[model samples]
Target: MRAGVRNLLNIRTRRVSLAPPGLPRAFDGFSILLLSDMHLGSIPELGPAVVRVIEGLRADVCVFAGDFRLYAHQSGPTFETDLRRIVDAVRAPAGLYGVLGNHDTIDDARLADCLGIRMLVNEAVSIRRDGATIRLAGVDDPHTYRLDDLDRALAGAPKGAFTVLAAHTSEIAADAAHKGVGLYLCGHTHGGQICLPGGVPLLVSTRSPRAYACGEWDLRGMKGYTSAGVGASIVPARFNCPGEVVTIEMRAKSSRTRPARTSCP
Candidate 1:
């Protein structure tokens, strides 16, 4: 790890938050905590820290967006213990949902099942509350080997349900938008793992444009957030773009009024 980056991790993960806009009325007061790109294999403080953050956030639903592990090679052992410990912290009003990132391995299946985490690897599930239904689908990270078929990921979803898709890369937002998805959540860029002045990511993964590097994005009618993530890679430290715990409250957008706060265009 870079000496400077190590020092930042010692300061604790940073909290970057925003409310998801364009939501329909069903989730008016719901809160969903998003954890993505958690490169737990490299960062030591992250696992324990994720545990602490989840307990504190107390969100109604916690979504482990992707990248629970960083190295496919060591994932069998390190993630066997550490990653599960980190992900186990997540809690939702009903249950936690997860997807696999490029770095994740087959071993993640054990942990995902052990923790009762809903594994969304090319699958869809329905969540219901207040006599309303929300359809959520999770797709494996496409950057590694699998071909990303948006149509396949959403094959069985019902129409007019609050459809949310979780993939590892923010680029999937476009596909979600095209498919009329109400919400999309993902994180694979690590928010560039480094930030320049004015919160600009100096570097980013291949999944998206730099503008959508670390926060909320408005894509036509689709709305979502890409967390800066709670872990690291290449180096085990974050500079200006510190680790993140993002709190997302799902509000039902009203036709009568514009959202109280819209994301930066």
Candidate 2:
């Protein structure tokens, strides 16, 4: 999942197949759209950019992990407007699901309600499509408001249902894998905004250093891709890393083996 930012600019509306080779016949690929950290108040243009991406991609489900707005002390209609623009632009394939990120203040709560987004606050919702049942769960921003209880979020889920977990932090993958999640989508690291010599980020605002950083990584029992995020943070500059909206095609992994494959944003 760690690729040069220059490579992501080449991303267009096309099927970049991610189905691992040697997949069993039991499952077909699941189409998923992943976008995070738009920071709408900071980068207003990001809303339309994301809408265009949404229009271009043909997907089964879409996930916006978190950080809808930049931190604003004077929260009011203007802040709500910024949040509304971003949320309204998001056209989820199935539905728009989200959590809050640290930069997002109390304004996020009202925005979540106003935008009609299905805010998942440490809870899960089950939905069915094409005869497949999926368990979707999301947690609040762990930084300012942490209510991440993987067990509680996933309680009573059907034993065989496909599970997707969305969070703002990539570290949640460790717990997600232990909870038997099939996929986890997160965006906190801006793909190492200032990439280092080996494409590593110099500074990160996340609670924990990004282990997965930006791009795909496989945990013990789960697989996921972390978006570099659409907007900026802190200094608002990107070097070797370009922001991205990740499109992932998920095929069920076999219990017997992990297939070798290559993926991009």
Per-prediction TM-score to the true structure, in the order listed: 0.86, 0.79
Clashes of each: 3, 1
* Per-residue accuracy of model 2 over 164-252 as CA lDDT, tens digit each: 88888876777777767877778887676667656667766666546676666777757776777776666445566666766677665
> For candidate 2, what is the lDDT?
0.64
Cα-based lDDT at residue 117, candidate 1: 78
* Model 1, span 1-265: residue lDDT tens: 4664563354333333333444556667676777887777575555666677666656777778777877776643455566667555666667788888887875675577677778888888887877788878888777775655778778877766677788878777777888878778887787777666455677787656765666777788677777777777776766666667676767665524334542211
Runs in model 1 lying further than 4 Å from the true structure: 1-24, 75-78, 255-265
Q: Which candidate is the best by lDDT?
A: 1
The most accurate candidate by TM-score is 1
